[model samples]
Target: MRKIVYLLFLGIWAVIGPLHAQTVKSDSVFLKLQQAFMAKSVGLLEPVLSNDFSVGVYNSPIAKYMLQNIVSHFAVDSMKLKAVERVSGKNSVLFIVYPHGEPAITTRAWLNDSHKLLYVDLFDQLCGLNRYKVSTLQATIPIEVKDGSIYLIATINDSQKPLRFLFDTGADGMAMRKSLADSLGLRVAREQNTSVVGGNMQIQVSTGNTIHFDKFAVNNQSVAIFEHVREGTAGIIGINLAYQYIVKVDFDKMIMQLYSMGNYNEEDKGGTTLSIKNGKGILELPLNLKVGQKEVTGNFIFDTGAGYYVIGFGDFVKRNELLSSGFKPYFSSTTVSMGVSSPTFTGNFEKMTVGAIDLRNVPGTLKKYREGDERATIEDGSFGVKTISRFNFTINLAEKTIHLTPNQRFNTPIDFMLGDKMFSFNERGQLAVLVDITAEQLFKQGDVVLSINDIESETLKKDPARILKLQAMPSGSKLSFKVLRDGQVVTISA
Candidate 1:
């Protein structure tokens, strides 16, 4: 009995030993690190840091430059050492940092396996770094509209079959549908915390050796894989373009042009130029709005991935205070990659502006996330494609500038129910259902919707451009559907 009790005690201690060592001297060690960073004295931190420290995100030279740049600008106000081994790896400590005037930061410090300081992980800084390369001086690509969204057709590797990809400005990394990736036997590079349209998740990141365009190609690019992708799209070409070229989108003409950094000239681009702040591919600009009795301005992500017009965070929306009059619940959406969504509240603001492009009575939502939720986006809010598609825009990658020219559709009211559901064309060449992102209950996950507003699914499949435009059309604030559920035909108005 005595021997067994002693062995049990040893087992318990074995488990707790590493846990305790991970946090021991964490406060004093991080304090010294912060002090040394401000002093710019490599010698001061030599005792705590490993002799061979490596930077993870970029090449050595650029990573060192980025590191020093951050050290130089770090606020000397306060430093708090926190344990987050799960995020930063074993024996990690981080500061709950608030950059003096900039956005809140999530940074982690690294320790070697021997419990010596290895390096620091500045997630925000690393994510914002753009070393993207483009080989083309100028190129033009045709675009097709489907379900009220713009899509680009391209090839994977040397394959003859063309796959459709969304030209999304808001996505940080390029992403593909898991089903497509599985069918192609693509490699998943890693799985980590990542952001989606209006939420965040631990997503599977994949890599494609080559993504070939007509005259250009991106080599060794990484893409995230989502469980749920809208039917017809194989993946999305995200903000990766921002690192390499200037992109001009003309929806009316159904054309897209890419210009190399040196070849593109923003001076000739005439429109309302908005100076956007960016880190990684995420873009945020000053958004001015008028609530009931007060006017406010805040930085919001200019996100094209989001389907809604606007979605704000808790504090940001509270300050704007558009909910005093009790705004109604709009559409709530979530991808299968991520389950249920955060509660969303909706209302209209008197006026909203991104630079000089103005819109009146714009519908917006507040996505509610608990404080300090890792799923919470770093930005106070996001601006979606619904409002942005109304403009002809030019995004200059090298300069971090966006020019917007209002189109006639700019005056069109934001839709209350911009319904987007999961679907795929069946082997029999008919549109089949997968899931619905909206809150309304219309059909089960596998039910096949034969038609919308009397338009035949077979005809729309043959000509998807027409279906895209009609999908966005409002049917008296509800949809009339002809669905085949369990091999039985049912007509329902939802």
Candidate 2:
């Protein structure tokens, strides 16, 4: 009996000993983290953080320089370890942090096999903690449509004056022009290189800023400042808003609705419901489209920031051999993002099936990847606002679903590309030739277009609707352009 009791005691000690040690180690790590925040130093965390330490659900590894920048400028007043648990078979701890002059944040940090800190997810926590529950239960804001994108009024921290912001589902988080940030005097916390549609550029991140959309406000948010944005808009509000609220965009009514996630009813919207894939920071949806007679099925990023109907990524286009395929090509154009432009060819698709709805004769663009272009590696492409605006859509990130109901423009014919020339508005709101594929080269690239078909550039700038009119001109129609080339105004006709 004594021998059996000794063996039993050894078994009990074996079970409890490691758990106690783990608790002690976790406490030590938490203490070091708190000290780091208190001192606004990353050095205190270096000893315990894993060599492969990353941030967010996307597992983006933080380099030493970026970590130092972020930690030194972190605005947390204090941090406390609230709880520890086993999450998805990994050791995880919860922390409650108070930002100076802002609400508290409850985030989770994960530990590696040796109990070293591996990852910290702060954006998800910020979205979860910020909830809106007013008497009306929803907020409706008016929107303006310009250049095939939706724009709305917003105000940055402590400012009552309104700024124009693009409602861009393509972007992961909030972004502003560097000029706007400089004017607002926002301090940069960290700087990182980011990939945009056309090319890559370095962007600065600013934290602890509040963005207000009428009465609805997002506090303690991070904003990416870019060197360039659309000409007339101050910044962009991305899909992060849907993570906190059920977002409904009504293009026909020119309004957007925001509802609390818990109080909203998906069934009431009455549209074809589709599941949304939670990507690194973007949202994706399955797309079944038909080009000519061939069926192409894949996932596409739902991008409200993009102006065209659809654009196939280089990988998707190359794998499917879409350029050589039998589809008829319309004209050559360029896709621009952050002031960088890439060559693309626009064509018509037989039909694009979105849930039960079938959109016929839709125009799509295919880009030919440049050598060493990083965007060529993406698996799929995006559906832009020109296509999305045909439907009244509701995005509920909490439920990972999107409800799309076709509106009055569901069957409207897409604007046919007029010729082998394409133009876009420059930063000064003047039209410039982006691409000219004609054999004669009637309009050269970088030519400032003064008038097209007697419509003045100033009029086109003021009335965006006229730009669409120019795009929809019937094929075989003769067109003339008054352009500023070199130092003299020249008239070109084709």
Candidate 3:
């Protein structure tokens, strides 16, 4: 069986392209606005946007509310428009935003017949368009989740801190790590069989006193604490404590905004929201999904922590015949580091279609272990950067909706995707390769990348141009690298 894998990433642009008459010329208009914002030109945006224009940053009425709530006093280091494209016959312009230390982004704006801005919407790489507001506040909160009812994770304090907890929307109460529980002198929530939509699991839970989130503090909060939680995960602030207000996740600015839920009165909101149905839940998107000839539907966890797409092995074996098709398919297998126990087997699958977009050769892994007669079932899974990089996603938790837009910069370089290749940072901050290898080469994982042809690693870091020429190298051909293994530098020809 032939194996196929669909991979994607954020893309970047070098220069603005020339525009035809009715279309706005892409020169520095976007960049100038970015710089103005960075320079705190709060008074200027009003004129540029004009009174006749209404900018909706997240495709909802709340977009304005978000910005107004935060921007009353906010500061930004920088905001750069990497690329711009005209949509809907020049009436709307889609802007892709790239900010330092933030995830990839794309946003949409609509202009009235008079060329005045009508509305704007923002999209994060993982979650789709969310109600967002640009604020002068220099602080930002970033969140991520591996698995759960809610796809997002929250960080209240400093993001770089060694001790931190993720916010879970599905958990009935709060949870905490054993280490933090020990330090806080709090007892673990009593262990019980808690039933979640995904499945039933055992966890410790307890109530807490006060929960602090930056300047926004909740006093005498009924917070649940879980002990013996996974390592590196200090605890969780779940939905039982969440829904207090209108929440905004601004990926472009790398900020998470929390509003008093009372402020959200307008019914119109972002993306489709999820609701309980027959003891399960459903998050409906506007698009349809199909696999092979069958239409696939179910509740799926929008997990960002899963580096790769995963599915239950039993379903894979039952539904897919790739293994017996006579082709040797290569699968990415790694240790399951989430909880405890031994390593398990995981296989990859091919071909997954979401509406008209067909992801060819997309890889999947078996998520559960198998014993004779004992079968395991997995909750549905959704694509992440492993495949979602092809498009921009906007997740509106308030509305429980997700929006997908074609990502212009869908294929760009990021550190996470650089695999098995030895690299050093060049002066331009780009990862520069110090060695070259081909399909036929035996490039072991730990093989020290010494030098490229004659250029040494040190020299390559100083000059990235050395490896750029290797792009012309043919597959299956020998590429030489001087490597130091054991000790001495030796030529390890690939």
Give Cα-based local distance difference scores for all models.
Answer: 0.64, 0.74, 0.41
lDDT of 2: 0.74
In model 1, which regions exceed 4 Å deviation? 1-137, 146-148, 197-200, 267-269, 291-294, 318-322, 325-340, 371-375, 411-494
Model 1 agreement with the true structure over 298-336: per-residue lDDT tens digits: 778776666656667665665456556445544444322
Best TM-score among the predictions, by candidate number: 2
Residue 156, model 2, lDDT: 91
**TM-score of each prediction:** 0.57, 0.61, 0.45
lDDT of 3: 0.41
What is the Å distance of residue 277 in model 3 from its true position? 7.7
lDDT of 3 by residue, 142-240 (tens): 544222112323332223334466544333345666556656665554666554322335655554455555544554444444334545567655544
* Per-residue lDDT over 362-429 for candidate 2, one digit per residue giving the tens place of the 0 to 100 score: 77888877664545335378888878877789887654578898776554434444577656653345
**Candidate 2, residue 12: how far the Cα is off, in Å:** 44
Best candidate per lDDT, number? 2
Estimate the TM-score for candidate 3. Answer: 0.45
